[model samples]
Target: MTVSIWQADGTQPVREVDFLVVGAGIAGCASALFASQAGRDVVVTDARDIALGASGRNAGFMITGLADYYHKGIEQFGHAAARELWALSIKTHDYWRAWAREAGGVHMDQRGSMLLAESLEEAKELELAARALNADGIEAIYHAADPLKRGYFAAVEQPWDGSVQPVELAQAVLRLSGAEFIANNEAYKVEQISAELVAVHTRKVIFHARYVMLCTNAYSFTLHPYFRGMVIPQRAQVMVTEPLPDSVIPVCGYSDYGYMYYRMTHDNRLLIGGGRHKFFEQEADTTDDRVTDGVQGYLDGYMRRFFPEVNARVDRRWAGTMGFSADGVPLVGTLPDSPRIGFAVGFTGHGLAFAAGTAERAVDHLLYGTHPGALWAGRLTR
Candidate 1:
């Protein structure tokens, strides 16, 4: 199963490694980093060029907590579990920051997330949600009117959430760890070659290893068919405005529970994302990166509606696909019967903050047979 990827140049043979990881996104890189840290010979490869998937195309919003809001998380997963998840999210953010520092630091933007309500009723709901979260020891502030703006938009602020350059962060992790990265390589199927080893067959080469980790989010089905309905791939589009005027848009802001989001980068560029839900059926498919004019129109309309003063024009527009699970929480840890295989996917659009930590903890469990205690402990297949 040799596949060709653009910009991928290299020739290698069927080789053996202590650990083999698929997908070059953050999860795969983090897994390789952990395995190498354990003094294990590791090989990490991906179908496309490194960081060319959701990891590279993501909005890079470094949010705190799970995919669900902190307040909603408590109701969905209970107070104790939600708090535990929040703690782990903070820890993961710290881990990424440390990794960035070691690798010359990431494009770090400490700007917080602003949640704007589209209507007054939604504003009240947001206020209640913020109060609930604060009562549960989380930091969230509610505003009756968007203080950052002049008009009637109500909003809430989460001081902990921030943003980063997705591709730069992944590249930094790979460089700092010095892991063997085989880009433009595709692993179609993984077969268990032995009790403690698996074989990953690509088009040009075969990689045999003691363990194989699937970190390819939406494309997980290509390797593990069982993940079909369990992990759905949804397409998302993002557009970046050419550097804007100094004081045009705020650093970060989102509307409708993060469905439509826009932020002004440090360089004064407006980065906006989210329009998949508009074309739900088309967006949910596993294949397809084509951007529809309808979706783009909606995004443009959203920009105009929010930033009426600034006539921002998009300098770059791209599409990314993310994994969404049934429960909204990430599927971390190992598979039920296959201890030699571990994965951390189904991030549900919450990959940036937790993917690194999930991979580290997953590899620890795989190599050491010890389990971690957090919201992700028993949430996976195991």
Candidate 2:
């Protein structure tokens, strides 16, 4: 979100608004939606247009939990918090589905998703995760053997989770938000002019607003100094193959502890992503959204190792940045220096899994001072 001296020169037009939401991605648009619903005059502005960021570039799995398995999540954040995050994921999916129904033209396939295990040890973990989820009345099937017969060991099938058109869903939410949307506007800096007014200096305009929600996600570090180390950027590489004559993957498939994922797109093309863990040094702490040969080569090898039967040529390749929090969960709270400037960032590559619900809590916490449990930013300090 860098602005050159030649671009703005600090002469941008000044605009007044009730609530200003930065980053027109899922979290930002969802923030705008919730804030407007709460009777605030909200405006959403972005460096890029709606759905042009990570929200549009995802594989669109409406997975009903964090990036970790249920048992792993329990280990990381404790049982209660893990359950709450799962519930949040479900609630977020519900919001997206409702928006899909309301807006139309969005495709949602209800075939569900499978968490495949690449090794025997991972298979055992999958079984444990399935049992943990089932104990909590979360219906997940444990398959002892690889269902796809793609040389994987085992899997946990979440029958309720589904794939979606993420970009379409984002657009639908934006339209339903009813907030004025300004595109190609990058917020270079933000300052609290007073207790009641926050000045958001952007490339195209400066906003004087009572409240501002920074849903900037991966690019959060650039807007304010406070975001440094709070939200780290991780780049994700993805590829889609030409439409196959037959579907290679029936459900959204994840394997290698989520280091690799493949899903059948709506048009019958196979979309593959991940491979970042192998090239961690290159992928971490970078906002550059360029496809790397190392990761893309990894995806190529992955496709060959698992789905060698698919001979269709790769049609497209691209990359996007994901915001990883200090903890792997989202960060929801207002800035200590400026309480009126709130934020919900750090989805940890689970933006589709957490954005809507996190945004909902962020809005509630910002406008009503309600505590956003599990993802409270105060926990980072403690």
Candidate 2 positional error at 38, Å:
0.7
Count of backbone clashes, every candidate in sequence: 3, 0
State the lDDT of candidate 1 residue by residue for 1-382, as single tens digits: 2445532233447788778888989888888888889888888888887898899988888877776566788888888877877777787788788888889757877778888887787787788778888887677888888877745368878887788888888998877667788877788767776788777777557777898888888888767766767678889888888997675655477777678878776577888888777778877865567777878888898878777777766898888889887677776666556778877787788888678877877788788876755535355445
Q: Of the candidates shown, which would achieve the greatest TM-score relative to the real structure?
A: 2
Q: What is the lDDT of residue 205 in candidate 2?
A: 92
Top candidate, metric lDDT: 2
lDDT of 1 at 46: 85
TM-score of 2: 0.98
Q: How close is candidate 1 to the true structure, as a TM-score?
A: 0.92
lDDT of 1: 0.77
